[model samples]
Target: MRILRTALLVALVVGVSVSALAKADAPLIDAVRSGDVSVVRALLDQGADVEGAAADGSTALQWAVHEGRAALVELLLGAGADVTATNRYGVGPASLAAENGNASILERLLDAGVDPDTTMPGGETLLMTAARTGEPDTVRVLLARGADPNVREELRGQTALMWAAANDNAAAIHVLAEQGAHLHARTDNPSRSPGRTFSSTPATGFTPLLFAVRGGHLDAARVLLDAGADVNDAVSDGQSGLVVAAANANWEMAAYLLDRGADPTHAGAGWNALHQTVRTRRMNVGFGTPGPFAAGTLDSIDLVRQLLARGVDVNARMTRNGIRDGQRNRFNRLGATAFMLAAKVTDVETMRVLLEAGADPLIPTADGTTPLMVAAGLAIWNPGEDGGTLSGQEDEVLEAVRICLELGNDVNAANYRGETALHGAGFRGANIVVDYLVEHGADLTALTEDG
Candidate 1:
């Protein structure tokens, strides 16, 4: 009975002591978080736990470094705080310092024996983090302290220079380049898994220049180009810088790339920048009311003119087994020209531009689908599923049909499937186009090959 009483008394005393210790440690963390140097010193003097962590596993020293409290950081280190302590996110004091652009604090941490090349949980190095901050001093400090400028992250194989370029950090890009970062380092190429075909997988081979162009960072792109980055470098999918710019309707970037010797005729299989530009514009700017034209529309027109002036073929056709094969509706077909693509979307303005640039409206696809057939909504294989209807685009389709007819397309012409523009209009339930076709002498007796 006596021993049981003594054990109970001792347990009670130990619980009280542990609770007191926790109470003492809580104030130290709060003091560090609030940047109270005197309070932190007093807590340490009172034997507060220097390594006490908040709920997120952030110790006093880590908080000090993150908050840029150099004096508190020094005091904590003197109190035997762990410099290598990390938060639950795997972010250590050094990484926080780098990400915050506190070069002096980073140097102090490095001097205190933190590994300069320490990576995050995902293998992102301090230099990569600093580069993304757009601070040249932090990047310089990391590089000077032996952080590799060319070191790639484990997941994407992206270097510090790539990160800098992606974030529009031109100064960091310049520094990384001077430190021997690879000018054309690409991300890891996407691998085709066992059941996945190459076309089903997305392209992942993006260089620093491509990253800059993808973000529309003209200054970063210029820095990379002047540093000898390849202007014509493409991803695994063959999308070059010019094609990317065209796809995004970035006329300025496209013009810049063209001036820097980007091949206007460079094609990914059968699709060129012109095709991308027209297709992208059609998707972004749907057929609205006839316009005085938006600023973006005018810019796209200028880009088209520039592409034509640079010698892009106005009548270029998609190849038999091209990059966009089996992708969707009319665009999936072979021998389809840019004019036909514009026609399919009922983009009368683009069709006019193509005609002015000498595009042949009579050119047909491999299936003998003419620009007129496409304009009348006859080219879609599955009219119900694909965007084949001229429901709201009756005016545009009528104008396009008129343009095709005026350009000498025979209204009675039939595709290889024996389907005429009338059949196309009927398939899409476009009574407006059907009536117009009938008025234009479409052969009502025409029958498809199946009939």
Candidate 2:
């Protein structure tokens, strides 16, 4: 916005200007920055150049805008400061005003005939800047003055609408959309990150509707839908809004999408909403989550119920995503069932929800690893939580083991390795689960194919 905020700029400009003119008469720049009106007037009277730049190419006018000094901005402009001067990041006075939503300063710059279409170094225009900063009023003023809402940023080809959608700025989104923003525009050449669900699609495949879901902006999503966004629209990989909604644990959005005709059973990249809904962290999270506390166990449980009621395949399995090795990888080796994924997680509430919703506890994968064996084989403490007494966590995992046994999953069932659920527990030091399994008739002498 301001190239950087004052707090950060203060840190960046730790010493004197590291420039060739380190000893030049740069008091006008320093005075304007400190908001010392008397010193600024004195510098102007002393024939100081009003358009002088700092080490980073930031002109006095740009610094005034950053400091929110409206009077100083006007004074500098009247003293022949160039409104078009920019900083190292190509952010000028006008762009800074719009980004900060400083309407008064922005009006003066716009009235001075500044071109609103000019972009910063990264192709961010005034409207895109305002939208990213959640500034509806600035967006309205710019649009009214003939700013192009559909103008694509040069780098990512994102219009102001895309930025609005990404930031959850529903008001800005509405303003831009009403001003003729393109609804179905896809980003150009999106960055590729393999470790993300949003990356299930290739670059250049994200639409505004998909971005809304990715941002978890329910109101913005509804606005787009009411404005005629295609509910069934998907990325190039066929990751529909419904699948994203569920995968992101956005139950309300998922519900709305289903009501709007999104396919509840749509699968993308060999996985469905069921796989994402039950996943504790990896798939459903850690891939640019909206916020740290945005997803929760309660929401996941609710989503599980919603998907089940909407007729998603409860025993839906995702093939083992990639090559697997090591005995501890058993849970993932055999294509994972939703129940299996949930059992390996500590959130037993979600596991219970799936179980109650008719997820088969004994469903086996290609290698014969069932959800029961997966739960029993899980380590009592996560690697991060190792070296602690395993009582609390052991109880949680044992809850899944108990549920599986009570529901008739074989206590002695083995995987392709011939390792029983009891053996699985024994491998991971799940003594509590081992005792329960043995009490339920688990064979003590079972051996893996390796043994």
Candidate 3:
């Protein structure tokens, strides 16, 4: 089977080289494909352009590098093929060799004076490319050859540190940092700061700090803060590391930022950390979260309790103004009464903790989505899929509904989409929830806009 695979690969290479030669200077590329080092040497000896590019901008050296023909690559390089020259897409031979995980060929090119830090067409440096492809050896080789660890790409100014952080390449990130990669440099948030232009400023005004937090790298976050990096540095989007930590449910990092003077009040400011917590706890599965410390070891419930105890203002608002045209709406606009995020497994406990922590169950979300509504809506999908109803626990959803009602939740409140909790229940075929709501005197005659 292995022999068959080898033969197939060889045939494919031959076929591709023949096709490429049919278009432009195919013979040299074919010789490289066939691993005919002597033939490649002869072509170069005859003054055929070793660096002469094909129609796709690939030189003979690039074909050799792609095929892992180390000796052929060396021969082309000896013939003065521009080892640093990039193809049309900016991927040079070094970068391709790294992509193919050919560390030996990469070292040969580097030793022969090929530039390892060269950027491809889209601004990916050979080092960045190597790290992304999980070629740790190639990464080491590039770094040893003085590839700029802190080199920022074109669009977002992401240094190798940022790339490693975003991809959770801890070892590569550490190597670059240990080699004096700037940990505090910021990159552009193109998603938030659209229409922004790139500048050569060393201070990208956005650093790798928040990315560390977003990645939930507690150790990395500690390292950055210990290096005197700003714990409260805000991104171009006006969000801080504290906010990202909370978004990622990195409580340890969140707690660390708080200890370092991170203001949780600045988080979901108009919405509040407690408010965001309620929403986030609902997406626990989506976030790949582990349940809180322990059922008693500080479960999600206890974690919420701790944040509140730490002065995360439970009643804080997320946005100041109400909704408007062409402007973002604040999460606090849901009548500033009792609100509920959509239900998830952790949300049940989160709701219980919030009620215990003084979260107003009366205020609806900005769009009039209520806690009971969320509970009922989630019950319909059986999001927990624990063979349960919308209320989750045998009585948990009902208990939460009862709390909201006791806290003055308008059982008749309708969302902006004109759906009520009962409608949501009926829509999702949650008969248990429908029956429970009816028993609790829930209005059944209410009609929604969609209905």
- Each prediction's TM-score versus the true structure: 0.84, 0.80, 0.66
Kindly report which residue stretches of model 2 are placed more than 4 angstroms away from their true locations once superposed. Answer: 1-25, 30-42, 154-157, 188-190, 193-204, 259-261, 281-292, 295-298, 319-330, 333-335, 346-348, 378-392
Q: Number of clashes in every candidate structure?
A: 1, 0, 22
Candidate 1 regions with alpha-carbon error over 4 angstroms: 1-24, 191-202, 284-298, 320-330, 379-392, 445-451
User: For residues 150-213, could you state the per-residue lDDT of candidate 1 as single tens digits?
Assistant: 8877666778888888788999999999999999888883642111121222447778998787
**For model 1, where is the 10-residue window of minimal lDDT?**
192-201
Please provide, for model 3 over 1-451, each residue's C-alpha lDDT reduced to its tens digit, 9 standing for 90 to 100.
Answer: 1232243345334435444466446778777878987887887777776766665567778889888988887778777788787655555788778777688999998887788778765467888777655556788889888888877777667776666665556666666667788877877635333111111112235576776766666666665666566888765545566655555456666667777888766642344445444444443222133322211122334456666888876655446332111122222344342135423232455566666778776666567777677566432333333211232453665565566666776667888777777875665455776787788777888877766
In terms of lDDT, model 3 sits at: 0.61
Error of 3 at 129 (Å): 2.9
Misplaced by over 4 Å in model 3 are: 1-55, 67-70, 97-117, 130-151, 178-180, 189-206, 217-228, 246-265, 283-306, 320-339, 342-346, 363-399, 406-451
- Please report the candidate that would top lDDT against the real structure: 1
As for TM-score, the candidate ahead, 1 or 3, is: 1
Measured with C-alpha atoms, the lDDT of residue 387 in candidate 1 is 27
lDDT of each: 0.74, 0.69, 0.61
